[model samples]
Target: MIHDLLLEREQRRTISKLGLDLMITPEGNIKVVEINGVNSGSSGVRELTGRDIDLEMITDLAQNGLPLFHLGKLKDQVFPHFVSELSHQQLLAQKWMHPRAPQKTARFVLPIVPESSDILEGIIWNADSDYYVFNERKYLLINPFAVEHAAGDKSRVHALFQGDLLAPLRPKMAFVVRANKECDVSDFKPNTTYLVLKPTDEMIGRNVIVVPTEDVFCPDGSLKEHPLAAYRRREEGWYQEPNVIMEELISSKKIGSSRTGKEHNGCMRYLILVESDKGEITIKHYGGYWRLAPSSIQDSNLQRQLVANYSNGAIPEHISDDDLAEVRKCVDTFVPVLYRRMLRLPINDRPDDLPLEAYCY
Candidate 1:
């Protein structure tokens, strides 16, 4: 149901790989929250080893420098940023690969310079540049052109509410707002309830705030400063970003959930879509987990952690079997359609590139 949002080239530079985030309501509705890239999922090997497991990628890049390309000053910014991140990772890998031990106990001794190897050769949309460098170089990104114009945007997803197929699964209402203009919570149904506010471009639950309609404004009747203003101000000075999302806060229904019988506020379902050699698409059920809201909204110490973004490490350990299955079914049906739309877009620069066809099931 997503549509395109016009953006300038500089604004589009950060577009990377796709990791769609979805919320499962108590009534069994599947609603898309947002999309992301370079989120907090580590590979199985990295998890087991407790380290970045792709030393071969670093060795190859340093030994045989691959062609680096970017739009405008991106190359200047991206190249150095990646080199520093990779260099730090490489040093750690080198340390672990060699240890002061008996010859028999020593792991395979890696040389000062790593041997070159071939990695995946393809472009990754909405990718994290630094993370990509240590992961693998074979999948050399074609840069700039591969980024889908507005792939992971909340604005684009909000516009999709009009589509018939998504209407049932979507939220009752949502809209965009800027920092300068305060939100009119009275427009939403049950004006007495809370509303979900999120910064459009931010990820990892950085600036997501769930506040009651009345609490949003100050005692003096002026709009309160953003929840993230202090932190963001320290980082980039006093400038309110003009784009934020305001949506009807869907109160998650209590379920006979968890082995402990304690109720959770809500849950998140993560789904992934991959393309095969013949341009076939496959939707994989990645992971589903529960998320809890703040216990006391009035307590300033309590923060409403609405987004269950993996990067923020907001995973709930317990979920009932039925809840998991229902979410899975919804994801299996919904993701293929999303992938099909993605395939229709021009996602590659190579002539041999093929569009994603039917779902592989």
Candidate 2:
């Protein structure tokens, strides 16, 4: 009831794959006071984000072929400015035996390397609380959404919100929308929260419009039309997480799902992204909890060959068509991009790694 269960599962799967926080159950049933989210408004929610370590230094190390451990260790220092503040109070309350406040993990947007024709379309709506970044100057685009004020009467809205009250809401995403803008929303229903991998540049205080889910997905396959439609589809078979289906899709030239018309069904809608290296191109597919990189072999033939190898085969007899369609989305999108910034800077480049920290406004 609180969030999109499918997207939530994908979200949990995503963060776990990236070595982030574990998912908690009853997320919807959880006390409003304890659930983490942003307040809705005409303007939108806005939060600051940055990293502690230097990107140039990290890039330099990478170029020099230095030990990867340093990079990993440096990763610990990277935290979202907004999340750090939220985490601080949560931890303090935990230490003092006080009621714990909801804490949001690091999230953000990264810049698309302009002019680089290689954009991964499957990852346009990626968002994760904890983000990982490997760039010196990176940012994330965020979308704004509303949650019923369940977190205890805004007792300390100031303490929790960290950003200016009249400030806009900004959640990291692959794209950004300005205030008063109307964007396409996915077939996703209203009040239904879906998780995405954080895309990299926030429009900085701007809320992006998303297309409606109904207009987004075809009619028959839409989850709203038939609740069972979105369930995992088994006929598509088990391709495992991060597998790609385009080779089969393009080859078969089929527009429908992986369901054999039996019990198994598949994703109701698909994620459509426009990427540009020399120019922008369109990519469409279901996405979540998976990073499907069609091995970037130099040879185009090899790339096609690699994709074929990764395509899903026939769904298992026991697998429900619904199940296959849902999980199969994992391989459809690009990995979520992370934008990390250190809040408390240290004089020495290396600050003893710190568990994500935060400060109240």
| Candidate whose lDDT is highest | 1
* Worst ten in a row by lDDT for model 2: 243-252
lDDT value, candidate 2, whole model: 0.21
- For candidate 2, lDDT tens digit of each residue in 61-139? 2342222222112224442321222243453343311221224533333334555533222111112212222221111
Model 1 segments beyond 4 Å from truth? 1-18, 38-126, 129-151, 177-192, 214-237, 255-261, 276-280, 294-302, 305-315, 345-361
- Candidate 2: list runs displaced more than 4 Å: 1-228, 232-361
- lDDT values, one for every candidate: 0.42, 0.21
Query: In angstroms, what RMSD does candidate 2 have relative to the true structure?
Result: 21.6
TM-score for all predictions?
0.53, 0.17
RMSD of each: 13.9, 21.6
TM-score of 2: 0.17
